[model samples]
Target: MRMYEIVLDGELTSDLPATAGPVGRRQEGGSTVLSVPAAGRDALEEVLGLLESLGIGITAMSEVEAPA
Candidate 1:
C-alpha cells in the first residue's frame, strides 16, 4: 500500500465517503488535507473519483510515508 496526502482547495463541510479509505482529515489554512492509504493506482483513482463527485477541488497531491 501507499500513503498519499491530498490537499483540497477548501474546507470540507462534511465527512468523506467511506470509499475514501481509512483517511486522516484535518484543516490547514484554507485547505482540507486528507491522508489516504491505497493499495495501488486503481484504489487511488477510486478515491479521486469520489472526491470529484463530491465537487471537492484538489489543490495538491503527493505520496507520503506512512505514519508510525
Candidate 2:
C-alpha cells in the first residue's frame, strides 16, 4: 500500500466520512489534510476525484512514507 497526503483549501470535517480511502485526518493551518492509504494508483485517483467533486480545492497531493 501507499500513503497519500491530500491537502485541501479549507476545513472538511463533515465531508471526510464520504471519502474513498481516508486512513486519518487532521487540520493543518487553514486546510484539512486527509491521509489516504491506497492499494494502488487507481484507488488513489478515485479518492482524489471524490474530494475534488465536493468542490474542495486541492492545494497539494504527495506520496509519503507509510507509518511503521
Candidate 3:
C-alpha cells in the first residue's frame, strides 16, 4: 500500500475511501489536510482521474510505504 498527500485550494468530499480516496480533516492552526491512499498503479490513476473530473487541482503528492 501507498499513501498520497494532496493539497488543494478548496474542500473535498467526506465519504472518501481509506484505501483510495480523499480524506479531509482539520489540522494545526485551522488548516485542512486532504489525504488519499493508493495500493498500486490502477488505484493511483483512478484517484488522479477523480481529481481531474472534480476540477480540483492537486498541488503535491508523496509516496509512502505501506506497512505489511
- Local distance difference test, each candidate: 0.81, 0.75, 0.57
Model 1, poorest ten-residue lDDT window?
Answer: 35-44
Residues 1-68 of candidate 3: C-alpha lDDT, one tens digit per residue: 56666565555545445555444343433333454565556666776676687777765567765457
lDDT by residue (tens digit), candidate 2, 1-68: 56888888888877554435445778999888887775566657877777778777989988888778
Residue-wise lDDT of candidate 1 within 9-47, one digit each (tens)? Answer: 899867776765677789999888987775566657877
In candidate 1, list every pair of residues with a backbone clash: none
Model 2 global lDDT (CA atoms, 0 to 1): 0.75
Local error of candidate 1 at residue 27 (angstroms): 0.7
Query: Residue 62 CA error for candidate 1 (Å)?
Result: 0.2
Q: Which segments of model 2 are wrong by more than 4 Å? A: none
Candidate 1 global CA lDDT score: 0.81
The candidate scoring highest on TM-score is 1
* Models ranked on TM-score: 1, 2, 3
Better of 1 and 3 by lDDT: 1
Q: State candidate 2's TM-score.
A: 0.75
CA lDDT, candidate 2, residue 17: 48
